[model samples]
Target: MADIISLGIDTGGTYTDAVIFSDARGVIAKAKSLTTRHDLSEGIAGAADAALAAAQIDSREIRLVSLSTTLATNALVEGQGQRVALVMIGFGEDDLARDGLGEAARAGPVIFLPGGHDVHGRETPLEMERLQVALPQLAQEVSAFAVAGYFAVRNPAHEQRVRDLILRDAGLPVTCSHELSSRLGGPRRALTTLLNARLVGMIGRLVGACEAYLSSRNIAAPLMVVRGDGALISASEARLRPIETILSGPAASLAGAQFLTGLDNAVVSDIGGTTTDVAILENGRPKLDPDGAMVGGHRTMVEAVAMRTFGLGGDSEVRVDLAGLIARIELGPRRVLPLSLIGHRFSDIVIPALEKQVGSVHAQRNEGLFAIRTGLPDSMAAGLSAQEASLYARITDQPQPLTQLLTTAPQKSALDRLAARGLAHISGITPSDALHVLGRQGQWNAAAARLGLDLAARQKGGNGKPIAADAEDLANRIVQRLTRQSSHAILEACLTDDGETGIDPAKSRAIARALDRQPGVVRFSLALDRPLIGLGASAPVYYPAIAEELAAPAVIPDHADVANAIGAVAGQIRETVTVFVTSPEEGIFLLNGSGETLRFVSETEALEAARARAIEHARALAARNGLAEPHIELMEDADAAEIEGKRKLVEARVRAVASGRPRVAN
Candidate 1:
């Protein structure tokens, strides 16, 4: 058999990576380009073209193409998804108070309907007059709709009706709670569907852009997308159910780590410009979160890899905390546009502004920072407060120094509100600038970086002393702080996997002393049981120290920077179907999920029927999604209780999984 070729692409917060891979030769060529937030296709095409040229291979020879991305995860973490209208059946506004639903619904509006099902799949009289009247106007406000009904999993009649109504009337995308998860918690499921609706248009744009690029290049191949579970799905599935791809980039990186290291168990860490993702691999597979994946403190019912996403990255906003007698450095829980990047892009504007700030004898409170209008449309800026609107009207494509931008007392709060809404960006001294100052990274303007760092260093701490002696000193401190935070993130992830939760490695006294490594009678140390495999372009510069701090061997393999792209092409397709059987009374068995409910007289007969149906459902789904010749496996879990010398059936769950290696396009 001859080797088959595949092209893989991964879009992240900072860079878009592309790779050309062979089943027999492994990675042949890889490249990266800056991610253009406004138009992602530009970045994807640039990296793909570079990789294809490097490999010297004809595009037609590529039999497969796969993609993974961090846009969804980043949007959820940064609170930047599109507006969505939520329809809750048999749920009132009070339901929004549970599971942080009200806060999650901050991006859009909610509607309540008097329709739903009971625990046993009994229906309530549905009311559609309100929704019918609001559909026309809502279409102008929101890009998508989410439908959730009480006990929808038991009987999704009301949810399906609402979905059909939205699609037929508004013609916009719709997400239903029951389709996402069959779990019993109505509020949590609604939260998941609401998030899915918010992300639909964003992910849809990404996938459509990639497809358009492929068509333009005459590269006709099977298009696949990496799911959050590190499995492959057709791009069509990604378009309809993008929430499943929340952690797509991180999951692909985990698979890439396994492929590069060939390790059975290890701690994997990937650092990008916007965030750092850490996960643990057990027996060569990243563990799946059983309770669902949580991002940005919002627990969503999205089944994804068990990983910790920290907002500490290269472009993280670097701030000096002056709380105590000694000043401390703090990295970001929010990302910002790097000063060096903006300086390089608009050197005429940003560089001159930075120079003016550094040379002025007058010290400004917002020194070394600038505000630039984010490229979002004007419609998203609607309903801004009077002050926010005033400040926003002044910000333009040209970077405005923060010192002048926030002249009034109320303008400061207005800028914060604007930034929170993703209407403007604060460009300041970030770790990327620090790296440029230290001469480790030179892709951007170094002079601007030096000036920015010098301005930040001159600031007085709580002790009324300068934070650092010079730019070089401040740069080193930032890098060291990143290293310490990275180590703590990795340790925190590992500890969480070991059933230990809520232990802050960064603040723990013993752990801090251990990482600090200062001599003392009560000395402490930490060591990992497995090696640390690092991925990302910055891994080479950052992970060595992180691994050393944890006393673990660092595996910085070849092509580490493009690992996510490599993993996108290196994975297989997986489809799963779950069937549930329950007994509301003796001598009666009911089966539901994946299809209409059925009744059986005997428990044994119901279990047999459920297992067969599950396998059939999985096989049918895989084939529909372009998986060729899938092999299916079945697992059954049954529950029962003993009472009065007889066993009573409670519930039984049967799951079938189908998987197979990806096949070449015909």
Candidate 2:
């Protein structure tokens, strides 16, 4: 039997891609299957089955399996997450609705109490009786809970106390904001915790499914999920903080793009069936957007590659202005054409059956018998009648011209007849109205099929239909315009602070408005001299072409279709823990923990304490990350200032390093 191999799978919007890698065979095999969003496990199982079969390996020979998913991200974006509750130990009701925190709180219930800590490690006093009363009152309704405090990062004791209280009384999963982030901003930190809470159940189930799948395949190795930053962490850790995986898809693509292009700097355009994504990479690293990015409609602060999305793709609904005579805009690949054009090319059920039953519209002599009907305007009908004799004379000699005439002047009633054809000639409905319905909410496949027939009956060609040259130009223009606008919005968001003046919104808006210049100035353009590469099936169709047209060398990589899965395959385990502290006496700060008194007499001591804490955190994470006998290091900082009689302060930083056993050859 072949040596055991690692399996990686990524579930995307349209497809689930799986890859197998073996030391002996190098890259063993890769497989793709349609994604079943209704039940992701179906798509995963199908992809896995295909990949294993392609590699010619028995399920028992598989050593490990890992998955990179966009499920959690999707759930958050589509507002399909569980109803969660936010518990604040010492925060006001208003805190839950502050800045980034407001976005997460919007997902569920929020409860605030009087118990908390001051800037120093001292307690701010709590209404314990009220908390006890509230815990049971709030517990039954929420599936998950998030607990955050004003200075939880500096002193998590109060937060931990609140968590214990909630856990004992509510029996619900709880995430403390301080544990998730060491950042100073309370609202952002709280938001991060709330997001983690909301995704807890979804991620847990997803990870559980993967685990079961792996065990069934006899895979013994541990599993790891890639974070939004393109780094890896243990499945257990990922389950706790699923928000980190929100941007893993794009990050992985950027990573894969970096690997493929071998360039230090460039811009990448990744276009998929649903949307087009553009990002800039410098020194082989995608820039991380610290401020929250909007996914679907909500904002999340997950580490993600900064990218601009355009609602334009091969499957985009092409809009046409049938309403106006002067300004008719032809929209879309909105009409996803049926494969019946070649006439019974395949045995694909409906489309094939439809073509056989109705015959070709181009071949029919009777206008009413034709499958492709036309909805002609009064003006166009007049023109057609004036040229009727000439058109009829040329029909046998120049059928192509006759067809062109019908394209320009379609009859309205014929459209209704065409819609009734059903399985005869129009099976795949591709209409702008149908596309709008599909894009909005529910499945409109049936409606789409009907609309496709109606569209076929409409005038095929008009002044609204642009030539191929004009289409290419238009695609490029749309890409440029959307990219500039989204990027400018992000830049403007990044610049705004509590009070400090930054990027002027009006100026940014002006820049976004004038998007006509090809290769125009982006608020944040990459060094394209080095080339930016894109990954994903649609990246080639949308990104690379746009980049090239913009005078930038762009590369859309092979296997870009499954780069996210590849990222899952090539990641390492990681973890992080953050503890907070507050000031006590003048020039003295105290750590709020369970153990010994970690007091900082000066700023140096406070900084040292933070470093030591960070190192300890990394070591613990290393163990969870499957690192045996993990080594560690520390780095830290303290923010302190004099106020009245005492110096108030806070401490923070990170300590991280790699630690893992070498893989043994079989």
Candidate 3:
């Protein structure tokens, strides 16, 4: 196992990283390529080929291949995914109003049915006539379906029946809420299943493409995917429940940071093109969010790392705020194509447009902005409204100035809709462009970056002056803003995780003064209790300043840029199952959970049965996930209350965890 080679890949918002790894020698070689929005396989193959060539390793030498991806997270955040119909069994329309489920449910139509289970695993008479009539029409309209039944976790009979019916009649992928989690929250579980359904086709396509690429190269290896908890699962399992991988890339980076720095306690901040994820490590392990992973503003029931994902990163959209006397520089909750990289790839079109914009005397609206087609296939463009279709048809391969492309407010909105659907992209100045202008990062088109900055600097401020004296000054301001925001994000995550109260990092004036190191009569200072471990391609360039502001030491490990890929390869397979032993009545114990139900007269017998059942299910899952020589650990959480001078058992949760490395090539 130590000698076997592992191939690791991570698909991120800006780049796809690939690495060749050996447990004995550590990271052997790593490569990064621009992530292609239109087609992901091209980027994956490019990085893999480069890494393999650098390592001088043949495809046959690799025994394992693992991947981490941000596509699912990005889709949920940006409202991009395949259309999926939600079939809510035993849930009402009012259920959608909770947990931001209604807003998230707008991806497709939601259908309600009358069939559910009681907390004790009792079934409600299921009525499927409405579903039967609608399945065929839904199959044509949606790419997948999500079904959630009340109390389905206690007994998944209703969910299973609906799943079987959909698979048989509609022939479409169906995600059942009980299959995603055993928790009892119907609406939140439905939200998770709804999201999982939407991501199924997208993730399945990505996994299929990777498998095909590996097969073509004769890389015969078991493929695995990094889960949001930083554990590994078979690729097939990942494709079925990709919502669990919402924080996959960030979770992998946590493992990579721990492995690279050997740190037991540190704050891990992994910055990527689209977002900066912040989390803390204690005892060399990241904590799981008990409330479940919250992505795209929806609190889901999928178990994941307690990571605070802030929409502040390299390619974050840069805009100027003129509401105040001093125009403020702001970064994003929205990501756009960086001007530098777009110019690097399409210089002929980008450079001339930018040049013309910079050559103008007066500062104009959207002078530094451009829109380009992502080149997605026409099938993805299906069901586009007339306004969106018209706007999209006008967008070509060549980057067009936003001022020219969007003449009216409605057209501007239409372009936004098109971008949201992944059919188009908007390019503008970003921190990456700022880096290029400052000569700190030279991977892209620096001249175009300068031109874009110059055009932006020409904007008249609220003070009736140019925003900056020159492009270089404006670039400095942008970088400083990013550093300030990054430090705040890290501090916020630390404070929240440490269970502190009242002091919000973003809004606290005292905290701001401390970070800014301002001179004041009432002086304040802040520092982290632990060092900051920064992991990402840009960590070396940006994290030192962030660490300095927080008064913490910076640990930027070697190959930090490819840490996500390294984490994917270094992770082990792990599966967990939980069973419940509840006393619904006196003198009787009812056992249920994880899709199983049983009855017992004695509490001792029922508790023991729950333990064995959990262990059995956990091991079965581990085996199915390719874990060899698996080790099982059990945890007992018993609940009791004093009642009438006697201690009565209320409930007991038996949890079993199975873990081991993936099986090597036979």
| Least accurate 10 contiguous residues by lDDT in model 2 | 374-383
C-alpha lDDT values of all predictions: 0.88, 0.55, 0.88
As for candidate 1, its clashing pairs are none
Question: What TM-score, computed on C-alpha atoms, does each candidate reach?
Answer: 0.95, 0.68, 0.95
How does candidate 1 score on lDDT? 0.88
Candidate 2's clash total is 20
**How far off is residue 150 in model 3, in Å?**
0.3
Q: Tens digit of lDDT per residue, candidate 2, span 188-301?
A: 677778878877876776677677767776667777776776777778887877877776666666765665566667766554443445566777677766655555444555
Runs in model 2 deviating more than 4 A are: 1-4, 23-26, 128-140, 273-277, 290-530, 576-583, 586-589, 592-597, 600-612, 629-631, 638-666
Higher-TM-score candidate of 1 and 2: 1
Please give, for residues 216-305, the per-residue lDDT of candidate 1 as tens digits: 888999889998888998888888889988889999999999999899899999998888999998997899999888887788888889
Ranking by TM-score: 3, 1, 2
Q: Distance from true position, residue 582, model 3, in Å?
A: 2.7
Count of clashes, each model: 0, 20, 0
How much is the lDDT of residue 136 in candidate 2? 74
The prediction achieving the highest lDDT against the true structure is: 3
Q: In angstroms, how far off is 5's CA in candidate 1?
A: 0.7
| Candidate 1, poorest ten consecutive residues by summed lDDT | 376-385
How many backbone clashes can be found in candidate 3? 0
